[model samples]
Target: MKTNRLKKSLLGITLSVSLFVSISIMGAPQAAHAATANTTTTAASTSVSGKAGSIIALGKNYLGVRYNFGAQKGVTSSFDCSSFTQYVYGKNGISLPRSSQAQSQVGSYVPRNQLQPGDLVFFYSPIHHVGIYIGNGKIMHTYGSPGVTISDMNSGWWSTHYKTARRVIK
Candidate 1:
């Protein structure tokens, strides 16, 4: 039984790697920091709803996990802000940079009102934190106590330090 599970896991990983390699070869690699000067942008109406929902669903599954600052990437045990976003999005076949600052430069910017599920919402100046916007102004992110919980974007610290949002699922 264990050997069968191992074979299945290996097969799945091989397929995923093949797809990722093919996609990477077909597209030019762009620096995630290239859009730093632009900072925030306002765009709407192009994101695919299905992808966003899948991303959010994956993120929601991590609720109650502890927040470990500087957690190792790809580890399911615990997650830092960026690593959390990276893993959740990666599970849905999207690649995100490893830091909040670089991630803040991703995708076309969307205004707060225009944010949809799966949009990456950033917080604080210089981009110290990130969360997956799960619609209705709530964000699913890991931080401090009650890790990975969904919180309102319009209230408390998140509201005060609201920086910008990126539509990475587009």
Candidate 2:
């Protein structure tokens, strides 16, 4: 009788331990999967941040370039509004259309207040001009007067002509 009780008790303990082990094994994969997903997300975010930084740096470097109508596509000596935007982003591995109107349609629409460092900002009633946002409500563009210059978004001309902004970097 004692032996029978001992055998039953041992069987119960074995079963409990087996169940605990099975549960742990099942949970381990889920935990690992969650960790892998987090790692991938972090990596993707870092890549995007790096791209944005590159765009801003390019914009800053080309701040003094002159504006030219129908400027050469690959050269930086002169640029139209769209060409200026394209050149800045293109240097960072992002390709934009040759015209401002077309570039406006390429990215997710961003509200004016949420503009980031490398956002493409549009302007004018006919959507004829675009610029690169450089934070602090300032934008860098190749305007007729200043060539490539930084202007406040609230400036007389820009404030009236401001249309929308778009975020191309993902």
Candidate 3:
């Protein structure tokens, strides 16, 4: 009886520690998100709700950050194309593979017309690039010249180079 009681006590302690760690990790992002937020209505605030608002809201904060090739994951210092998308979505509790090509395989395909906010958009010949669709036929991404910013999805090179779109949020 004593041995069984001790085991139960240990299990209880273990669970408490686990829950504490989880809460700590999760709370950090919520705090940062709330800190940076203004009155913007993200995909999370529209007719749909989930990770979109939180994801886009955070992505907006990175605007004007210069592009860096092969940026290390989790580093907000500078971001590459895939790293930008990965970081934004990752904050919302969604894990994506490191590369744009690999990240493309994680979500379900959606036609361009059906894309809503929080949708992942792919581009280029071999699908080596990606961005988050923020509705209104625009995408927020980092590449070449400008860092994190929005672009017209139907304008110029994007329209001709668009490959596919994926719905990562549901």
RMSD of each: 10.7, 22.8, 10.4
lDDT pick, better of 2 and 3: 3
Using all chains and alpha carbons, the TM-scores for the candidates as numbered come to: 0.71, 0.69, 0.74
Question: What are the lDDT scores of the predictions, listed in order?
Answer: 0.76, 0.75, 0.82
Ranking by lDDT: 3, 1, 2
Expressed as tens digits, the lDDT of each residue in 1-170 for candidate 3 is 99999999999999889778756755675676555534254533443235676777778777888899999998776899999999889887899999999988887999888888889999997999999987777789999779988888899999899999888886
Off by over 4 Å in 3: 1-48
- Tell me the tens digit of each residue's lDDT in model 2 across 40-153: 112113222355655654565566778888887876668888988887687657899999999999989999889877789999877989988766777778977678888888
Q: What TM-score does model 3 achieve against the real structure? A: 0.74
Residue-level lDDT for 48 in candidate 1: 29
For model 3, where is the 10-residue window of minimal lDDT?
A: 39-48
Highest-scoring model, TM-score: 3
**What is the lDDT, from 0 to 100, of the residue 73 in candidate 2?**
86
Q: Which candidate has the top score in lDDT? A: 3
lDDT of 1 by residue, 1-170 (tens): 99999999999999889778745742332222122222121121223245665565556556788999999998766898999999878866899999999999978999988987788999998789999887667788999978778888889988999999999776
Clashing pairs in model 2? none
